[model samples]
Target chain A: MSDPLLKVDNLHVEFKTGSIITRAVNGVTFELNEQENIGIVGESGSGKSVTATSILQLIPSPPAKVANGAIYFKGKNLLKLSSKEMRKIRGNEISMIFQDPSTSLNPVFTVGNQLIETIRAHKKVSKKQAKQKAISLLDLVGIPAPDKRIDMYPHEFSGGMRQRVMIAIALACDPEVLIADEPTTALDVTVQAQILNLMKELQERLGMSIIMITHDLGVVWETCDKLLVMYAGRVVESASVKDLYQQPLHPYTWGLLDSQISEGQNSAEPLASIPGSPPDLSYEIKGCPFVERCPYAQDICYQETPQLNETIQGHAVACHFQTSEHQLERKEREYSDGDAT
Target chain B: MMETLLEVNGLKKHFPVSNPIPFKKSTQSVKAVDGVNFDVYQGETLGIVGESGCGKSTMARLVNQLIKPTDGSVIFKKQNLIDMPAEKLRQMRQKIQMVFQDPYASLDPRLKVGELIAEPLVIHQIGDRTSQKQRVEELLEIVGLNKRYADRYPHEFSGGQRQRINIARALTLNPELVICDEPVSALDVSVQAQVINLLNKLQQDFKLTYIFISHDLNVVRYMCDRIAVMYLGRIVEIGTFEEIYANPQHPYTKALFSAIPKESPFEEKERIILKGTVPSPLNPPSGCHFHERCPVAIDICKTKEPKMITKEKIHQTSCHLAD
Candidate 1:
């Protein structure tokens, strides 16, 4: 494969106030290749968003601080860059689409004004030229009558349309990497499907990598090539979509995969819910964050933390037993299940 | 023999729309829930699933009597709740309870968890303070929450725990019928599973009937014994979970099933992409409301609304092309 487009190495982000310190992103390390769609799946406070924002240096600093890490985009350390240098990369080289489109777009200005301003900020262009570019961007994202719609305010657009506008602005610069944080979580299923398909099409046409941060496992399967599972501000598992779904090694990953109730997979038996809530991030986590809820947790699970270890060619699991005898047990069980069926 | 626990017929709740432009006299109403009909069998979970503007939630509120329906007859236990006296209706409310979508908003922040749960019993005069405290502790235990949490506040608990508290509160009067309005939608997938499992266990342990309302197709299928598909305030289809999932007749139901993001990568499923958004309820298309977005809509769909007709035993559909 070509050289990875983005590399996040040993990244740690913390939010501190007075004596309390919440380590939001703890030692998150991953690589995203060009033209690859990477999915970050985690519950709230799992530090998925923190990890993304850290790459862009977008975290508000009074409470949030990048304690340690190196984020290399095209062989340049983003953490070492000055504010002026970071601004050059923010929207031009990398753009982010937030969860709520209604709140993200400026309500006071027309869509045209905002889009034109973003284009002009990145490159030298006359107001008329920027306007034309903005209209084209709108048309590119599949909004009909771009000229008429561009002049309309954000409120005039529906939830799905506003999201289309958000995508239009994000793609105006033709950024190399697009980070979408729960882009369709707020939309209806049909609308969400449209947005996901739109993003898929845009990524293919534009040749940009996508980092999709969401809690939905189903979404990851539909859009992403690689999956990163986060738990309690830590990377718990990483693998290709097929590998991770087929053989999820981490106990937390197992619980998550088993718990979902998609169409046609109705089980009369109650779902296997991961017991207990996520660990509090304000204090230091002594051992595995998921140990409290993991049914397969051993004594070592509570005593020490496990690093992400590759058991197969591409699958990496963060668990003690996963690297040991658990694999044998799982194979035996699968064989028995296969035989019975 | 199945006994009907609750029955609703021709239920409607329309709110008059306000025109954005001044002096544009608005005669239109946002038909939030229009002419919905369903029967909840005793001890069976009935799910109402639909996206926004479909009126699944308004149906829940109407059943709970939280808001009076514009027109309909709601009969529970062989009594017409609509025409019931105020005192009689208040007494009947104790048998039916509702758990709201947002736990944070449903609960009074100032009240303690114990007080919050006991509020129902207190309003009904079920027991004295000492007995109520004991009952509250039992409720917390029933929902798999720490008994010590009775003294704690709602804010102290996480989203899952807060939902537990909300469930505990709903059961204070030992409500026979519990209407769950997206109880776990606000929670994470992991936490949602816990809550859903808890609801299932509680249903069996208490012999309670549930009117589970949610937009998540999976959750509805998992939780409900029978599923009702709503579209623009109408029951487009109703059937047993097996009947609906295995054989959904309505065009909207099929599209909804296809729209769900599938998890299995090995299975190559064909997705039916429904064009356009759900039209506004304010100016909904005449005849069949879903015709505008239906993939298989025909000419007849534009002129006349199909009545809910039985296609099989315990299966009903309202689509011209259902046959």
Candidate 2:
């Protein structure tokens, strides 16, 4: 309702491999409001991580060029910022939690040292104060006996504990927005739930907006307030969590949901897998990005790119046939029936 | 009723932690897999679900005798795999194959896909060189990869395709039981479905038995006929898919099911939110391993271990409250 904390408009990212330029993020646009939890869901290589990395100017240059885009963070144009200014903003005002904590964390450094260094980099504080803050942050993220464990190296910690340490470092600066890329993918279900719940609690406590990038729709449903469905370097659907799940207008969204075998479902029933692999993003395309894999793709869908049309309350879907109320009704009927038992 | 393919009783694997303290001689052992027991029925997928460090992977490896069990017995086809000799174990390995989690890491980079698939057949002396090549092509086709792609190396294939190649290699020997440890966990959700479907197809076509080990409950719910929920290196609950999903007995099982993200547009359930990490395996709780984190823990749970009791027909759980 209020002005977005971060607004991305017409963002296009291209990766050049010799003669070929792959459009990784093509004309993508979205906004994250204050205290909002938004999920960017897509299969691997769909540019979901690339788009998130672009927000913080973390993308590698030469190979990856933000061909055209406007990234407005808190009314400031992040794309236009100088390297010095960007450095000040990165890890100070915005922090990220990467997928693999084992790799993200320096194996040589003690957890305490990393946390203290991270805190001291952004703020001018005494060593004692910074160490205290580090221990506190670790305690905040549910690490046990932060004081003793802080001195241990990353190898000493288990996978779940290492991820918690990553979270602690990410939240050390108390940033306005936290971008977590597949934060729980490497974790088990119990630990995944713990981390997700921890993130939710921290969000409430700090009142910081979150941009969670994951391919797991289950994570999105459990944690995110808004959902952004990506396909082939584009946003095919975006809506509030309730609106998106209750009545997913896009066929791609339908396929993603249907492919998920719910806990209560009959195990013997075959999962309705989407027919084909994700389209290759190497070449440019004119029509809908999802047309190749979309079961409901029509001739019109292949011929022209569809705009994000508001089909229902706060729900947007990029599909020509999304306008057909009859089809929508049928889909709604099927979704409810499938969900019901 | 189907015949039992593999029966594991009180399996244990303890890796001694070498503390770098002189004269202290601290023999802290990580109880990775401590007294896990289960039966894998013929032609059925027995899903082993657990959190990291809960010893699901170790169980899979122990069942295949990749690592000798520290204790207990693995009766594969009435043969004690734990005590089997090297020669006989090699023969047993042909009937029990393993598909690892990371396809890229599991596959040999230098070997061509065809050779990779044919290696298993050659080692087991299943067929001659010409026949092995033909069987490799057939295996490639079965796993949904084109026969032409067999000439390419592992690095050339995508993650999903590489996994398919791994599956094809696993099936080359026509092993009756396959230990697929987190096979699709490393893959994309969409690609995961593709791999899962291919696995299902292969199981049906060959009547293969699968020991599906993963941390994902949703995946286990989908692929397995029966599910075992493991915690602290022990099975807390075991039941048919229907019974477990419908009426999960153990508190741990209940929490696990509730943790799964539901797709329906309904109000979120109040997660059990267990407190504290899993206890240190070396110094696990005296009685119930889950007592420290169990919301419904009783006084007796702290003092005495609860043996797994049959709650219903073929449905079993190890909880003091259940008893």
**Per-candidate local distance difference test:** 0.86, 0.86
The DockQ leader among the candidates is: 1
Question: Which prediction has the highest TM-score against the true structure?
Answer: 1
Model 2, A272-300: lDDT tens digits are 66666676788778698888776677798
lDDT of 1 at A63: 91
Q: Which stretches of candidate 1 lie over 4 Å from their true place?
A: A262-267, A324-341, B19-26
Off by over 4 Å in 2: A323-341, B19-26
Which pairs clash inside model 2?
Answer: none
Which tens-of-lDDT digit does each residue in B47-98 have in candidate 1? 9888887898888888878888899989999999997899999999999998
Count: clashes, candidate 2: 0
